[model samples]
Target: MAITNNRMICRTVFAATLLTAPFQIFTSAIGQVYPSLTLLFALMLFLFYDVSKVLKTSLTMKTWAALVLVQIISLLWAVDIREGIREIVYSFSFFLVFGASMQESKRNLRSLTLLIIAYSVLTLSQSTLVIYFRLIPDVKIQYLQGHLAEIFTSPNTLIDLFGSERNNVLDEAKSGGFEVNANTGAAWVGMVGMVTMGLAIGLRRKLLFFVSLFHLVAVFFSGSKAASLLVCCLLALMYLTVYISKKFTPSRFAILISFVVLLTVAGSIVVAAGSATDFGQASSDTLDTRKLIWAHAAVEFLKHPILGQGFGGWSETFQAYAWRQKISDGYPPHDTLIRLWSQSGLIAALVGAAFMIAFSVEVLTLVRSGSRTAAWIGAGIWCGFLFVSIQGLGENWGLLGTLRMSPFIAACFALSRALGYYTSPATRSSVLNTSVRQIKYV
Candidate 1:
């Protein structure tokens, strides 16, 4: 009977849940609405959305059980058991929701946009909450109290995270190593910010502009140089696309051209204004720190090729090099891929990179298709995802690598499916079969 209504209620609820949650991503401590809210929605769907009725076994849809199985196996061997297990729990649910949200075989573009917007709101609001409460409680401040950018270069490096003046940084009490790792904060910002810009430009939606803006703010506050730089790169790419396209009439072209000019002007003004603010100094310092970290990461990667060491092996292995070289760091290898290879071995890196490459191809196709909203969203989503990926090259991110590997990868898969980015021949045949069944009922 529920199937008779095209399961409209189920579909709508699933759509709304994904849309809202995608918009509000943030750090764990932030009072963001995404994780809890979306989990509830997934639970409701799991309870009522009959798989036998709505979903046919098809290659087009994401293989939920397969993902969960892989995650479980990986968790069993992971160096960080609690984190691995927690990620698997979150990712399993995430994949299920992602795979189940779309209709038949088609992608829903607006719903996806809504999901991205929801994350933006939740992240911005939660970030505000953190700022208001001043609840950035990290116990290890002394670890990062001094060495700003002295990792790669001499002890007296030119640029410092606290700026040219280390005393000013000490005065501000922003010395926690993990707190400023950027991967810890910047990762989330880049994840949301880069993607939103691409979405706004591709969709021609006004709301996404503000969505992009808030994400930008989050990136700034994260003090992650990689995040901020990626933002500039992604935004520039989006704008350049618009500027180069000769589709609009002269008036529309002029309007767009003028808007771009004004945007650049406004951005410059913002930059100049920010130069006087604490964020400007902090951001500049963060950028410098990343360079030092990047240099260190490159060296580590060079030392351990092919098999590398085992998982959780980088910290110990890296210290030997660090001590011999005299690089000051609160922890070991800074880059995500490098650390993964060092710890989990080359096999882990290949498995992880394969997913990224597959997802990227899917996203690229969606961008070029031009007819589907799903396609366009894929383009936008990748813009954001890439920023995170680039930043990942510098820091450990998620469940598989940087951020929190499972959720990031699962979200990628889910969104990819939503965009019709991963449709396969078997899946297409299954969808055709589903349509035939629906027609018989009619």
Candidate 2:
């Protein structure tokens, strides 16, 4: 009875974290506490109950360990050793808490999908209250103490919270729900929004599919143009995945994915060529700024080519190089791949690339499998990752220090292990039989 109760409590805590982990508003309300209290407590419970199992069966353990080691070794070249060490500790801790807690199974995947949808609903409701009724907390902005004023007394502060800087559409008082910046909220919503849509279609829940559209409205309210564009692209991809799953063979689906990727790249190049120097409009200005940042980053990478400036070297490197570029120090290279390459150099970039490729291959395998449920979950996770990576080209959401996006990434990868669990002989046979029957009826 005691063991059973403990197991139940463990599962409950894990479920709660899944629902609340992506929203920045929750983290802000809790005073910027990282990894969350629930995560820590659950880590303890996991240690007590399933430590051996977690260590033995975990797919990401070795890769995470290698990544951690790379960061630790890079500290030798890091100008800011203290910050570098802090990053190392953070990655290791996240591995222990989030990376270990994941179990590869269809049950857990479905639960995670539901929790993501719930997170979307909660965020949308919070934003709606702030937008319609001027309801926002009167507490201090814990995350932005120095950059922003300590206390938010008026509705203007609340409006600023939702990233009104780039948000021309929403009213000034639009709150960012749990996140301090509206852009981050938009990015968070965009990722989960894709998941909700994918899950709805995968599970044949028509009402859930329609209801999930509200999340896009929430993203628009966030007022981050980057997020808005990314969500639009992801929504198209989400629908495409559904259509392809129903109509195409596995080999054709793979070809379609490749073709779409090439087409997206070609379109982006054409757009960039058309507006390469237009600094008047927002979209063009953003593109121009990223190009400049990437240029600067490439120059910096040449300075310390092998290991680069090391982990958490962004500010220090920027401080040294900003005078040359005539820009402020806080403006990081604005690209995740460029930032990693410039900071940790070639080795770190390779590690990051390998990690992403492994993750992508795993997700793709699941999509190509005959199981519809597994395919939907895989496509959702894959698309969410692609959105973040695309966003990273214009911003640094996926960087190591950005804890805001970390939990969401962790959730996707953790749930992705469902491929192995759901592809057993019995499950595959059942899925195959169902597919054949449906085709016959058609």
Candidate 3:
């Protein structure tokens, strides 16, 4: 009876986590202290579960652990040790929860599908609400209800009501959703939306198709160029996955060759475009903002090179350089790869890179497996996560900060791994056959 009771409680908590993920907007819409109830519940679950399970299942997670250890060691030399410690704690807590909570089963897959749809809906709704306010200038519920109601208004409205007086909490624009900034909103959409797209294709769930479309609309409304591009890339990748599944036998050589060719073409195009313009040209200056930030970051990385100036030191170092160059401080270089190299040194950066490589390989292995449903889903997540990671080249907040989406990405990968095992060779044929019948019925 006690074991049964425990099982029931675990199921309830997991379900609650999925449900709570969508409602996070309600708190963010208001000026509530606990912003992400989903993350909070996730953290609670992480603490309550067995710690050993994290290492036993996911190979990617073991690499992640090494990355964390590197970061912890860097804290010894960090100028702001307190901030460095906080960063470590935040990372550890997130991975711990994610590792503990995710499972491999049909029931969990269904739950994940629901969670993705809910999250996408919430983001779309938030963006839509903001757009509505923008279109209808006279939607003055706040002014009619007095100063207190100003807090109840959307971030954009609050900015209009209080102007510069708006607190950081109230400082939102339509570019972001429930996240702190427009960029964060767009980043989350890119990562989570990609995961959803993968799961949808893998499960062959018709509902997810529409949900993904809605997610794209939300990403578009968020006004993130990186995110917009990521969504387009995700669609292209999904199409490619389906095409390959139909035409090819999911061979590693074919997939690798195709990926290499695609990347080469894309890289060549970017390089050609950049080389066509002079550095001092108008086109260059518009793009040079990020380049300049990166240039400054590169210099900082060189100065420290090995152990680095330590966590939070890159920004300080960049600020000093920016002041000399008559540019502003407080804004990062908008690149996670370089930021890691600058802040944590080559060791930490190598660890991070290893994690990415390991995770990608694992997903690819799943894709090449006999499990058709698992393969498509794994492909979706791998492609989606790749899009987000590529987009991170220009947008640093996708990882290792308050705006980080890496944990969720990890969780999705873990889910894919779990689902891959659940749908083995013997069972996959049966599952696909049943799915075909069900589709025919519908």
Best by TM-score: 3
TM-score of each predicted structure versus truth: 0.57, 0.74, 0.76
Each candidate's lDDT (Cα)? Answer: 0.48, 0.56, 0.58
lDDT by residue for model 3 over 205-323, one digit each (tens)?
Answer: 78876666666667766545445555665667665664554334537436754764585456445545766554224234435677788788777777777886787777667777778
lDDT string, candidate 2, 1-442, tens digits: 0134455665666555445444322223333222344344434544433434444555455555666777777777777676666566556555644543464223244455455556656655544532332233333233233333323222343445355233322334334544555555566656666766666666677766665666666676665656666676666675576557545475776775675576566556655666644312445666676676777677777877777766666666667666776755556667766666655677777677666666666666656565676667668777777666667666764443244445556656665554444564556566533432231121
Worst 10 contiguous positions by lDDT, candidate 1: 149-158
- What lDDT tens digits, residue by residue, belong to model 1 across residues 1-442? 1233446676676655555453222213223112344455655656544443323533322333444455455544455555455545564555455445444234444444454455555556434422322225232233244443232112322234345324212333322122334344455655656666555655566777677676576655544444555666666655543343334244653563365456545644565567668656655554466666666656666766655554455555556655755555344455655654554456556655665565555555444433333334555566566666656665655333322222333444445554443333444456543432221121
Candidate 3 weakest ten by summed lDDT:
164-173
Question: Candidate 2 has what TM-score?
Answer: 0.74
What lDDT, from 0 to 1, does candidate 1 have?
Answer: 0.48
As for candidate 2, its clashing pairs are 24-178, 24-179, 25-178, 25-179
Give the TM-score (vs. native) of candidate 3: 0.76
Best by lDDT: 3
Candidate 2, position 70, lDDT: 79
Candidates in descending lDDT order: 3, 2, 1
